[model samples]
Target: METVAQRQIHSLLAKYGESHLNHTNELIHFICIPAIVFSFLGMIWALHPLAAIAVTVVSLLYYFRLSVPFALGMLLMSGAMLWMLSVLSQDQVLKVSLAVFVVAWIGQFIGHKIEGKKPSFFDDLRFLLIGPLFVLSFLYRRFHIAY
Candidate 1:
């Protein structure tokens, strides 16, 4: 039987998958979404390292409830992104992250234009969080890991 969390994850992924039907759009997301996540982490890290750490902890807990393998993968990726963020000077983190965030969003809009669909987040904010998981689901599939 599917656990409640697994069922929820699958449902959310299916909803998220709808607007990402175009191959070019999916390809853009495969690159831009991670960049957006990294930049968001960096921006949070700039405010306070603790704030960034807190987000990571909460996010991992949420992911853990949904899928253990995905949570682990996200944990590793989060660690690396945090490490990269930590190395930048405080001012540099803000500037660099802002630049990346803007560029990544531009890429997202372009992809959506090609897809001819409004972003899922416009209809529901939680899709913002679901986007990264959508990308990770692809990785999980390639590895034959049940998520």
Candidate 2:
């Protein structure tokens, strides 16, 4: 029997997939989603490292409630992003993050234009968080890993 949490994850992924059926859009998302995430985190890190850590902790807790594998993946990903941010000078973090955030969003919009569908997040804000999971789902499938 499918657990309620499993059902919820399935339903969310299926609904999110509706607008992402276009191959071009999926390809675009494959690149842009991670870029957006990293840049977004970089922005928060720019404000204060502790603020970024707090956000990551909160997000990981939510992901853990949904799926352990996903939470673990995000934990690793978040750590890597934080490490990269640490490599940059304090002044550069905000500037680089803002630039990447703007460009990635533009790419996302262009992808949606090609897709002829509005972003899933426009209908439901949770889809913003789900977007990363959606991308990770593909990796999970490719590796025969169950989430």
- Which tens-of-lDDT digit does each residue in 1-147 have in candidate 1? 998988999999999999999999999999999999999999899899999999999998988888887899899989999999888888899899999999999999999999999999999988988899999999989989898
Give the CA lDDT, 0 to 100, for residue 98 in model 2. 95
TM-score of each: 0.96, 0.98
Local accuracy of candidate 2 as per-residue lDDT tens digits, 17-135: 99999999999998999999999999999999999989999999988888888899899988999899999999999999999999999999999999999999999999998999999
Most accurate candidate by TM-score = 2
lDDT against the true structure, per candidate, is: 0.93, 0.93
> Looking at candidate 2, what is the lDDT of residue 36?
95
> What TM-score quantifies how close candidate 2 is to the native fold?
0.98
Q: Which regions of candidate 1 fall more than 4 Å away from where they truly are?
A: none
Candidate 2 off by > 4 Å: none
For model 1, the run of ten residues with the poorest summed lDDT: 62-71
Assess the local accuracy of residue 6 in candidate 2 as a C-alpha lDDT between 0 and 100: 81
Residue pairs in clash, model 1: none
